[model samples]
Target: MNETIETLLNHRSIRKFTDKKLTDEQIHTIIKAAQQASTSSYMMAYTIIGITDPDKKAALAEVSGHPHVTQNGHLLIFCADLKRPVAQATSEQYEATRANLENSEHFLVAAIDAALAAQNAAIAAESMGLGMCYLGSIRNNLARTDEILELPKHVIPLFGMAIGTPDHQPELKPRLPISAVYAENEYPAYEEDVAAFDQELADYYESRSTNNRKDTWSEQMIRRFAKPMRMDVTELVQKKGFNKR
Candidate 1:
Protein backbone atom coordinates (compact mmCIF):
# COMPACT_ATOMS: atom_id res chain seq x y z
CA MET A 1 0.00 0.00 0.00
CA ASN A 2 1.04 3.59 -0.55
CA GLU A 3 2.36 5.66 2.34
CA THR A 4 -0.80 7.82 2.41
CA ILE A 5 -3.06 4.77 2.57
CA GLU A 6 -0.93 3.31 5.34
CA THR A 7 -1.18 6.55 7.29
CA LEU A 8 -4.93 6.57 6.86
CA LEU A 9 -5.35 2.95 7.91
CA ASN A 10 -3.05 3.20 10.93
CA HIS A 11 -4.90 6.15 12.43
CA ARG A 12 -5.61 6.08 16.17
CA SER A 13 -7.06 8.61 18.58
CA ILE A 14 -4.22 9.63 20.87
CA ARG A 15 -5.09 10.63 24.42
CA LYS A 16 -1.75 10.64 26.22
CA PHE A 17 0.82 13.14 25.04
CA THR A 18 4.32 14.23 26.00
CA ASP A 19 5.43 17.66 27.21
CA LYS A 20 6.96 18.35 23.85
CA LYS A 21 5.09 21.06 22.01
CA LEU A 22 4.48 21.88 18.37
CA THR A 23 6.52 24.62 16.68
CA ASP A 24 4.91 27.72 15.27
CA GLU A 25 5.91 26.62 11.77
CA GLN A 26 4.39 23.22 12.35
CA ILE A 27 1.11 24.78 13.49
CA HIS A 28 1.09 27.04 10.45
CA THR A 29 1.76 24.15 8.10
CA ILE A 30 -0.98 22.03 9.60
CA ILE A 31 -3.48 24.90 9.42
CA LYS A 32 -2.45 25.64 5.85
CA ALA A 33 -3.21 22.05 4.98
CA ALA A 34 -6.57 22.42 6.71
CA GLN A 35 -7.34 25.49 4.62
CA GLN A 36 -6.71 23.47 1.48
CA ALA A 37 -9.65 21.19 2.25
CA SER A 38 -12.63 21.53 -0.09
CA THR A 39 -15.42 23.91 0.96
CA SER A 40 -18.97 24.18 -0.29
CA SER A 41 -19.23 26.87 -3.00
CA TYR A 42 -15.78 28.09 -1.97
CA MET A 43 -17.26 29.37 1.28
CA MET A 44 -14.80 28.34 3.94
CA ALA A 45 -17.25 28.81 6.75
CA TYR A 46 -14.88 27.57 9.46
CA THR A 47 -12.62 29.15 12.05
CA ILE A 48 -9.91 27.39 14.02
CA ILE A 49 -9.22 28.78 17.48
CA GLY A 50 -5.87 27.78 18.91
CA ILE A 51 -5.82 27.85 22.69
CA THR A 52 -2.45 28.68 24.21
CA ASP A 53 -3.17 30.24 27.55
CA PRO A 54 -3.09 27.93 30.53
CA ASP A 55 -6.22 29.45 32.09
CA LYS A 56 -8.20 29.26 28.87
CA LYS A 57 -7.12 25.68 28.25
CA ALA A 58 -8.11 24.82 31.79
CA ALA A 59 -11.50 26.40 31.30
CA LEU A 60 -11.96 24.48 28.06
CA ALA A 61 -10.84 21.28 29.75
CA GLU A 62 -13.50 21.84 32.35
CA VAL A 63 -16.01 22.37 29.57
CA SER A 64 -14.98 19.16 27.81
CA GLY A 65 -14.45 17.16 31.02
CA HIS A 66 -11.26 15.78 29.54
CA PRO A 67 -7.88 16.38 31.11
CA HIS A 68 -6.25 15.73 27.77
CA VAL A 69 -7.94 18.89 26.55
CA THR A 70 -5.64 20.86 28.82
CA GLN A 71 -2.62 18.53 28.71
CA ASN A 72 -2.13 18.54 24.95
CA GLY A 73 0.71 20.63 23.54
CA HIS A 74 -1.70 22.40 21.21
CA LEU A 75 -5.46 22.67 21.36
CA LEU A 76 -7.48 23.80 18.36
CA ILE A 77 -11.19 24.46 18.41
CA PHE A 78 -12.85 24.19 15.00
CA CYS A 79 -15.92 26.35 14.64
CA ALA A 80 -18.62 26.68 12.01
CA ASP A 81 -18.69 30.42 11.32
CA LEU A 82 -21.18 32.40 9.23
CA LYS A 83 -20.54 35.71 10.96
CA ARG A 84 -17.95 36.83 8.46
CA PRO A 85 -20.12 36.35 5.41
CA VAL A 86 -23.09 37.90 7.11
CA ALA A 87 -21.00 40.89 8.07
CA GLN A 88 -19.79 41.25 4.50
CA ALA A 89 -23.29 41.59 3.07
CA THR A 90 -24.45 45.01 1.85
CA SER A 91 -27.20 46.84 3.75
CA GLU A 92 -29.67 46.07 0.92
CA GLN A 93 -28.70 42.36 0.97
CA TYR A 94 -28.59 42.04 4.77
CA GLU A 95 -32.08 40.62 5.21
CA ALA A 96 -31.73 38.01 2.46
CA THR A 97 -28.27 37.07 3.67
CA ARG A 98 -29.44 36.71 7.26
CA ALA A 99 -32.41 34.59 6.15
CA ASN A 100 -30.17 32.23 4.14
CA LEU A 101 -27.64 31.97 6.92
CA GLU A 102 -30.38 31.05 9.35
CA ASN A 103 -31.53 28.13 7.22
CA SER A 104 -30.75 24.59 8.36
CA GLU A 105 -29.04 23.84 5.04
CA HIS A 106 -26.45 26.56 5.65
CA PHE A 107 -25.94 25.24 9.16
CA LEU A 108 -25.19 21.79 7.74
CA VAL A 109 -22.88 23.33 5.16
CA ALA A 110 -20.92 25.15 7.84
CA ALA A 111 -20.69 22.00 9.98
CA ILE A 112 -19.50 19.92 7.04
CA ASP A 113 -16.92 22.54 6.15
CA ALA A 114 -15.53 22.47 9.69
CA ALA A 115 -15.41 18.67 9.73
CA LEU A 116 -13.62 18.45 6.40
CA ALA A 117 -11.02 20.97 7.48
CA ALA A 118 -10.47 19.15 10.76
CA GLN A 119 -9.90 15.82 9.01
CA ASN A 120 -7.32 17.49 6.83
CA ALA A 121 -5.62 18.92 9.93
CA ALA A 122 -5.67 15.47 11.54
CA ILE A 123 -4.03 13.88 8.54
CA ALA A 124 -1.42 16.59 8.47
CA ALA A 125 -0.58 16.18 12.15
CA GLU A 126 -0.29 12.38 11.84
CA SER A 127 1.89 12.64 8.76
CA MET A 128 4.17 14.99 10.69
CA GLY A 129 4.79 12.38 13.43
CA LEU A 130 2.43 14.03 15.89
CA GLY A 131 -0.45 12.40 17.73
CA MET A 132 -3.89 14.00 18.00
CA CYS A 133 -7.28 13.35 19.51
CA TYR A 134 -10.61 14.85 18.54
CA LEU A 135 -12.49 16.45 21.47
CA GLY A 136 -16.18 16.26 20.67
CA SER A 137 -17.06 16.44 24.34
CA ILE A 138 -16.74 20.21 24.08
CA ARG A 139 -20.27 20.01 22.78
CA ASN A 140 -21.39 18.37 25.99
CA ASN A 141 -21.77 21.85 27.45
CA LEU A 142 -21.99 24.05 24.41
CA ALA A 143 -23.18 27.13 26.29
CA ARG A 144 -20.26 27.08 28.69
CA THR A 145 -17.85 26.36 25.89
CA ASP A 146 -19.21 29.29 23.94
CA GLU A 147 -18.81 31.54 26.94
CA ILE A 148 -15.24 30.38 27.46
CA LEU A 149 -14.37 30.99 23.84
CA GLU A 150 -16.30 34.29 23.70
CA LEU A 151 -17.91 33.37 20.42
CA PRO A 152 -20.24 35.88 18.75
CA LYS A 153 -23.52 35.17 17.02
CA HIS A 154 -23.49 33.06 13.85
CA VAL A 155 -20.44 31.13 15.04
CA ILE A 156 -20.50 27.77 16.80
CA PRO A 157 -17.71 25.54 18.00
CA LEU A 158 -18.27 22.10 16.56
CA PHE A 159 -15.28 20.26 18.03
CA GLY A 160 -11.70 20.53 19.25
CA MET A 161 -8.44 18.72 18.53
CA ALA A 162 -5.61 18.08 20.96
CA ILE A 163 -2.26 17.56 19.26
CA GLY A 164 1.16 16.81 20.65
CA THR A 165 3.98 14.24 20.83
CA PRO A 166 2.76 10.76 21.64
CA ASP A 167 3.32 9.42 25.15
CA HIS A 168 1.43 6.21 24.47
CA GLN A 169 0.68 4.04 21.46
CA PRO A 170 -2.84 2.63 21.43
CA GLU A 171 -4.13 -0.39 19.57
CA LEU A 172 -6.06 0.50 16.47
CA LYS A 173 -9.76 -0.01 17.08
CA PRO A 174 -11.67 -2.20 14.63
CA ARG A 175 -14.22 -0.53 12.40
CA LEU A 176 -17.42 -1.80 10.84
CA PRO A 177 -16.91 -3.99 7.80
CA ILE A 178 -16.89 -2.31 4.41
CA SER A 179 -19.97 -4.27 3.41
CA ALA A 180 -21.83 -2.51 6.16
CA VAL A 181 -20.47 0.91 5.33
CA TYR A 182 -20.20 0.96 1.54
CA ALA A 183 -22.98 0.34 -0.96
CA GLU A 184 -23.47 0.76 -4.68
CA ASN A 185 -26.82 1.84 -6.14
CA GLU A 186 -28.70 1.95 -2.88
CA TYR A 187 -28.17 1.41 0.84
CA PRO A 188 -28.07 -2.31 1.57
CA ALA A 189 -28.99 -4.17 4.73
CA TYR A 190 -25.96 -5.24 6.73
CA GLU A 191 -27.37 -6.89 9.81
CA GLU A 192 -25.11 -9.90 9.33
CA ASP A 193 -22.06 -7.74 8.81
CA VAL A 194 -22.88 -5.67 11.90
CA ALA A 195 -23.30 -8.80 14.00
CA ALA A 196 -19.92 -10.06 12.82
CA PHE A 197 -18.29 -6.74 13.48
CA ASP A 198 -19.73 -6.66 16.97
CA GLN A 199 -17.81 -9.82 17.77
CA GLU A 200 -14.65 -8.46 16.18
CA LEU A 201 -14.85 -5.25 18.18
CA ALA A 202 -15.59 -7.08 21.41
CA ASP A 203 -12.47 -9.15 20.94
CA TYR A 204 -10.40 -6.05 20.25
CA TYR A 205 -11.75 -4.30 23.31
CA GLU A 206 -10.89 -7.27 25.50
CA SER A 207 -7.39 -7.69 24.07
CA ARG A 208 -6.37 -4.04 23.94
CA SER A 209 -3.23 -3.03 25.89
CA THR A 210 -4.89 -0.54 28.17
CA ASN A 211 -8.31 -0.21 29.76
CA ASN A 212 -9.34 -3.60 28.50
CA ARG A 213 -13.04 -4.24 28.72
CA LYS A 214 -15.65 -6.74 27.63
CA ASP A 215 -17.98 -4.86 25.34
CA THR A 216 -19.46 -5.30 21.91
CA TRP A 217 -20.07 -2.62 19.31
CA SER A 218 -23.79 -3.32 19.49
CA GLU A 219 -23.75 -2.90 23.25
CA GLN A 220 -21.93 0.37 22.97
CA MET A 221 -24.44 1.62 20.45
CA ILE A 222 -27.28 0.62 22.72
CA ARG A 223 -25.80 2.58 25.62
CA ARG A 224 -25.26 5.54 23.34
CA PHE A 225 -28.78 5.67 21.90
CA ALA A 226 -30.78 4.30 24.83
CA LYS A 227 -30.97 7.78 26.30
CA PRO A 228 -31.33 11.12 24.62
CA MET A 229 -27.83 12.57 24.40
CA ARG A 230 -26.87 16.26 24.40
CA MET A 231 -30.57 17.17 24.23
CA ASP A 232 -29.78 20.85 24.66
CA VAL A 233 -27.74 21.03 21.45
CA THR A 234 -30.67 21.98 19.22
CA GLU A 235 -31.83 24.77 21.50
CA LEU A 236 -28.28 26.09 21.82
CA VAL A 237 -27.74 26.00 18.07
CA GLN A 238 -30.99 27.86 17.51
CA LYS A 239 -29.90 30.41 20.09
CA LYS A 240 -26.83 31.00 17.93
CA GLY A 241 -29.13 31.96 15.04
CA PHE A 242 -28.87 28.69 13.16
CA ASN A 243 -31.45 26.11 12.06
CA LYS A 244 -34.23 28.68 12.44
CA ARG A 245 -35.98 27.06 9.49
Candidate 2:
Protein backbone atom coordinates (compact mmCIF):
# COMPACT_ATOMS: atom_id res chain seq x y z
CA MET A 1 0.00 0.00 0.00
CA ASN A 2 1.10 3.56 -0.60
CA GLU A 3 2.58 5.39 2.41
CA THR A 4 0.13 8.30 2.05
CA ILE A 5 -2.81 5.90 1.96
CA GLU A 6 -1.48 4.12 5.05
CA THR A 7 -1.09 7.44 6.88
CA LEU A 8 -4.61 8.52 5.92
CA LEU A 9 -6.08 5.19 7.00
CA ASN A 10 -4.48 5.58 10.43
CA HIS A 11 -5.82 9.14 10.83
CA ARG A 12 -7.28 10.07 14.23
CA SER A 13 -8.08 13.26 16.05
CA ILE A 14 -5.50 14.48 18.61
CA ARG A 15 -6.89 16.40 21.58
CA LYS A 16 -3.88 16.42 23.88
CA PHE A 17 -1.13 18.68 22.54
CA THR A 18 2.36 19.70 23.63
CA ASP A 19 3.11 23.29 24.63
CA LYS A 20 5.65 23.77 21.90
CA LYS A 21 4.95 26.77 19.67
CA LEU A 22 5.36 26.33 15.93
CA THR A 23 7.84 28.61 14.14
CA ASP A 24 6.94 31.15 11.48
CA GLU A 25 8.38 29.01 8.71
CA GLN A 26 6.29 26.03 9.70
CA ILE A 27 3.15 28.16 9.82
CA HIS A 28 3.83 29.72 6.41
CA THR A 29 4.53 26.34 4.85
CA ILE A 30 1.29 24.88 6.13
CA ILE A 31 -0.68 27.87 4.86
CA LYS A 32 1.06 27.50 1.53
CA ALA A 33 -0.03 23.89 1.33
CA ALA A 34 -3.61 24.93 2.12
CA GLN A 35 -3.47 27.49 -0.70
CA GLN A 36 -2.51 24.73 -3.10
CA ALA A 37 -5.78 22.88 -2.52
CA SER A 38 -8.31 22.68 -5.37
CA THR A 39 -10.59 25.69 -5.39
CA SER A 40 -13.88 26.32 -7.18
CA SER A 41 -13.55 28.47 -10.32
CA TYR A 42 -10.37 29.96 -8.84
CA MET A 43 -12.60 32.41 -6.95
CA MET A 44 -10.89 31.24 -3.76
CA ALA A 45 -14.12 31.97 -1.91
CA TYR A 46 -12.57 31.11 1.46
CA THR A 47 -10.76 32.80 4.27
CA ILE A 48 -8.49 31.42 6.98
CA ILE A 49 -7.97 33.45 10.13
CA GLY A 50 -4.87 32.69 12.16
CA ILE A 51 -5.39 33.61 15.79
CA THR A 52 -2.37 34.57 17.88
CA ASP A 53 -4.23 36.71 20.39
CA PRO A 54 -4.92 34.99 23.69
CA ASP A 55 -8.21 36.80 24.31
CA LYS A 56 -9.52 36.00 20.83
CA LYS A 57 -8.46 32.39 21.16
CA ALA A 58 -10.08 32.17 24.58
CA ALA A 59 -13.29 33.64 23.21
CA LEU A 60 -13.16 31.11 20.34
CA ALA A 61 -12.64 28.32 22.84
CA GLU A 62 -15.79 29.45 24.60
CA VAL A 63 -17.63 29.47 21.27
CA SER A 64 -16.44 25.95 20.38
CA GLY A 65 -16.89 24.37 23.85
CA HIS A 66 -13.51 22.85 23.10
CA PRO A 67 -10.98 24.12 25.65
CA HIS A 68 -8.09 23.24 23.37
CA VAL A 69 -9.20 26.03 21.01
CA THR A 70 -7.40 28.37 23.36
CA GLN A 71 -4.91 25.96 24.95
CA ASN A 72 -3.52 24.69 21.67
CA GLY A 73 -0.27 26.23 20.41
CA HIS A 74 -1.92 27.39 17.17
CA LEU A 75 -5.48 28.08 16.13
CA LEU A 76 -6.92 28.72 12.67
CA ILE A 77 -10.43 29.44 11.52
CA PHE A 78 -11.78 28.39 8.13
CA CYS A 79 -14.52 30.59 6.73
CA ALA A 80 -16.89 30.19 3.81
CA ASP A 81 -16.87 33.76 2.58
CA LEU A 82 -19.41 34.96 0.03
CA LYS A 83 -19.07 38.53 1.25
CA ARG A 84 -16.43 39.45 -1.29
CA PRO A 85 -18.54 38.43 -4.25
CA VAL A 86 -21.58 40.14 -2.83
CA ALA A 87 -19.58 43.30 -2.35
CA GLN A 88 -18.16 43.20 -5.84
CA ALA A 89 -21.57 42.71 -7.39
CA THR A 90 -23.15 45.43 -5.27
CA SER A 91 -20.36 47.85 -6.03
CA GLU A 92 -20.33 47.09 -9.74
CA GLN A 93 -24.02 46.74 -10.51
CA TYR A 94 -23.52 47.95 -14.03
CA GLU A 95 -26.00 47.27 -16.84
CA ALA A 96 -24.20 44.03 -17.76
CA THR A 97 -23.46 43.07 -14.16
CA ARG A 98 -25.27 42.30 -10.86
CA ALA A 99 -25.26 38.70 -9.60
CA ASN A 100 -28.37 37.02 -8.25
CA LEU A 101 -28.27 37.03 -4.47
CA GLU A 102 -30.38 33.85 -4.41
CA ASN A 103 -27.88 31.86 -6.44
CA SER A 104 -27.13 28.60 -4.62
CA GLU A 105 -24.09 27.90 -6.79
CA HIS A 106 -22.06 30.67 -5.10
CA PHE A 107 -22.85 29.31 -1.64
CA LEU A 108 -21.81 25.80 -2.68
CA VAL A 109 -18.58 27.15 -4.13
CA ALA A 110 -17.64 28.92 -0.89
CA ALA A 111 -18.43 25.89 1.27
CA ILE A 112 -16.60 23.41 -0.96
CA ASP A 113 -13.60 25.73 -1.22
CA ALA A 114 -13.37 26.04 2.55
CA ALA A 115 -13.63 22.28 3.07
CA LEU A 116 -10.87 21.55 0.56
CA ALA A 117 -8.57 24.14 2.12
CA ALA A 118 -9.21 22.69 5.58
CA GLN A 119 -8.36 19.12 4.51
CA ASN A 120 -5.18 20.37 2.84
CA ALA A 121 -4.12 22.13 6.03
CA ALA A 122 -4.95 19.12 8.17
CA ILE A 123 -2.86 16.76 6.06
CA ALA A 124 -0.05 19.28 5.88
CA ALA A 125 0.04 19.72 9.66
CA GLU A 126 0.10 15.96 10.19
CA SER A 127 3.01 15.65 7.76
CA MET A 128 4.90 18.13 9.92
CA GLY A 129 4.43 15.89 12.97
CA LEU A 130 1.89 18.27 14.47
CA GLY A 131 -1.38 17.27 16.12
CA MET A 132 -4.59 18.96 15.04
CA CYS A 133 -8.30 18.93 15.80
CA TYR A 134 -11.19 20.36 13.76
CA LEU A 135 -13.99 22.23 15.53
CA GLY A 136 -17.38 21.96 13.87
CA SER A 137 -18.79 24.07 16.70
CA ILE A 138 -17.88 27.23 14.87
CA ARG A 139 -21.44 27.05 13.61
CA ASN A 140 -22.80 26.55 17.11
CA ASN A 141 -22.17 30.22 17.84
CA LEU A 142 -22.76 31.58 14.35
CA ALA A 143 -23.97 35.14 15.01
CA ARG A 144 -21.57 35.55 17.90
CA THR A 145 -18.77 34.16 15.75
CA ASP A 146 -19.55 36.66 12.99
CA GLU A 147 -19.51 39.45 15.53
CA ILE A 148 -16.27 38.23 17.06
CA LEU A 149 -14.53 37.91 13.72
CA GLU A 150 -16.13 41.11 12.38
CA LEU A 151 -17.31 39.14 9.37
CA PRO A 152 -19.27 41.10 6.80
CA LYS A 153 -22.54 39.99 5.25
CA HIS A 154 -22.51 36.74 3.22
CA VAL A 155 -19.64 35.27 5.24
CA ILE A 156 -19.92 32.38 7.70
CA PRO A 157 -17.63 30.29 9.84
CA LEU A 158 -17.18 26.82 8.36
CA PHE A 159 -14.97 25.37 11.10
CA GLY A 160 -11.85 25.84 13.21
CA MET A 161 -8.61 23.89 13.63
CA ALA A 162 -6.30 23.72 16.61
CA ILE A 163 -2.76 22.56 15.94
CA GLY A 164 0.20 21.65 18.14
CA THR A 165 2.68 18.87 18.81
CA PRO A 166 1.18 15.64 20.15
CA ASP A 167 1.25 15.19 23.92
CA HIS A 168 -0.85 12.05 24.18
CA GLN A 169 -1.94 9.37 21.76
CA PRO A 170 -5.64 8.80 21.17
CA GLU A 171 -7.20 5.51 20.12
CA LEU A 172 -8.04 5.18 16.46
CA LYS A 173 -11.63 5.97 15.56
CA PRO A 174 -13.58 3.29 13.72
CA ARG A 175 -15.14 4.13 10.38
CA LEU A 176 -18.34 2.78 8.89
CA PRO A 177 -17.89 -0.52 7.07
CA ILE A 178 -17.68 -0.49 3.26
CA SER A 179 -21.03 -2.20 3.06
CA ALA A 180 -22.56 0.72 4.90
CA VAL A 181 -21.10 3.36 2.60
CA TYR A 182 -19.95 1.90 -0.71
CA ALA A 183 -22.50 1.50 -3.51
CA GLU A 184 -21.68 -0.25 -6.73
CA ASN A 185 -22.58 2.25 -9.49
CA GLU A 186 -25.83 3.09 -7.75
CA TYR A 187 -27.33 4.35 -4.51
CA PRO A 188 -26.94 2.20 -1.44
CA ALA A 189 -29.46 -0.54 -0.80
CA TYR A 190 -30.95 -0.24 2.69
CA GLU A 191 -32.09 -2.85 5.26
CA GLU A 192 -29.30 -5.39 4.88
CA ASP A 193 -26.63 -2.73 4.58
CA VAL A 194 -27.90 -0.78 7.58
CA ALA A 195 -28.31 -3.88 9.78
CA ALA A 196 -24.80 -5.07 9.00
CA PHE A 197 -23.40 -1.61 9.68
CA ASP A 198 -25.29 -1.24 12.95
CA GLN A 199 -23.75 -4.47 14.18
CA GLU A 200 -20.24 -3.44 13.13
CA LEU A 201 -20.70 -0.10 14.88
CA ALA A 202 -22.00 -1.87 18.01
CA ASP A 203 -18.95 -4.13 18.08
CA TYR A 204 -16.60 -1.17 17.67
CA TYR A 205 -18.31 0.56 20.56
CA GLU A 206 -18.14 -2.55 22.72
CA SER A 207 -14.41 -2.73 22.17
CA ARG A 208 -13.99 0.88 23.25
CA SER A 209 -16.14 0.50 26.38
CA THR A 210 -13.14 -0.95 28.22
CA ASN A 211 -11.84 2.66 28.55
CA ASN A 212 -14.85 3.59 30.74
CA ARG A 213 -16.63 5.21 27.86
CA LYS A 214 -19.85 3.51 26.69
CA ASP A 215 -18.95 4.55 23.13
CA THR A 216 -22.26 3.41 21.66
CA TRP A 217 -22.53 4.66 18.08
CA SER A 218 -26.31 4.77 18.16
CA GLU A 219 -26.36 6.58 21.49
CA GLN A 220 -24.01 9.23 20.20
CA MET A 221 -26.09 9.79 17.07
CA ILE A 222 -29.27 9.86 19.16
CA ARG A 223 -27.85 12.41 21.56
CA ARG A 224 -26.64 14.56 18.68
CA PHE A 225 -29.89 14.70 16.67
CA ALA A 226 -32.58 13.88 19.30
CA LYS A 227 -32.55 17.32 20.87
CA PRO A 228 -33.78 20.50 19.21
CA MET A 229 -30.99 22.59 17.75
CA ARG A 230 -30.19 25.38 20.15
CA MET A 231 -28.43 27.45 17.54
CA ASP A 232 -30.78 27.03 14.57
CA VAL A 233 -27.74 27.59 12.35
CA THR A 234 -29.63 27.49 9.05
CA GLU A 235 -31.78 30.42 10.12
CA LEU A 236 -28.74 32.18 11.46
CA VAL A 237 -26.89 31.71 8.18
CA GLN A 238 -29.85 33.12 6.31
CA LYS A 239 -29.75 36.09 8.63
CA LYS A 240 -26.06 36.41 7.81
CA GLY A 241 -27.15 37.11 4.19
CA PHE A 242 -26.53 33.70 2.55
CA ASN A 243 -30.24 32.83 2.76
CA LYS A 244 -29.18 29.26 1.91
CA ARG A 245 -29.56 30.19 -1.76
**In candidate 1, what are the lDDT values of residues 71-153, reduced to their tens digit?**
88799999999988668778788877878789999999999999999999999999999999999999999988888999999
Candidate 2, 1-245: lDDT as tens digits: 98777667767888878788888998898899998999877878888999998878878778888878877768899998866654545455632222443356776778899989988888888877888989888667777777788887667887899899988787787666676677799877666766665676667666764454444566678898988774577776777666454
Instruction: Report every candidate's CA lDDT.
Output: 0.92, 0.77
Q: Against the true structure, whose TM-score is highest?
A: 1
Q: Which regions of candidate 2 are displaced past 4 Å?
A: 85-90, 94-102, 209-211
lDDT of 1 at 32: 99
**How far off is residue 156 in model 1, in Å?**
0.6
Candidate 1, run of 10 with poorest lDDT: 84-93
Write down the TM-score for model 1.
0.97
